[model samples]
Target: MQPGTFELLILIFIFLGLQAWWIIPIINKNNKFNKRGKDLREEIKQLEKLYKK
Candidate 1:
């Protein structure tokens, strides 16, 4: 016999779950790095403002 709709859906769900499990952490790490970079830029801007005053 062949696979049915439910099996197909389960397989798709598992595949997406695995993909997300691997990808989400990388995405989160990149986001954290981006936030840190943004914070550093803001601090530099503040320092420049203070220096010019």
Candidate 2:
């Protein structure tokens, strides 16, 4: 395989992995709120749970 092609593939994978790392948790938090509603205390508790873990 060509070195340039391999490097391009690695770059693409890194970009996608970084995007998921940043976006997935926000999506999950939003989903949690969708299930729990606009409860500030609940969100705070959730954040605490994650921090403890």
Best by TM-score: 1
* Ten residues in sequence with the least summed lDDT for candidate 1: 1-10
lDDT of all predictions, in order shown? 0.97, 0.91
Model 2, TM vs. native: 0.64
Give the Cα RMSD of candidate 2.
11.3
TM-score of each: 0.77, 0.64
Error of 2 at 32 (Å): 0.3
Off by over 4 Å in 2: 1-3, 38-53
Residue pairs with colliding backbones in model 2 are none
What's the count of clashing pairs in each model shown?
0, 0
Residue-level lDDT of model 1, residues 1-53, one tens digit each, is 46598899899999999999999999999999999999999999999999999
- State in Å the error of residue 25, model 2: 0.2
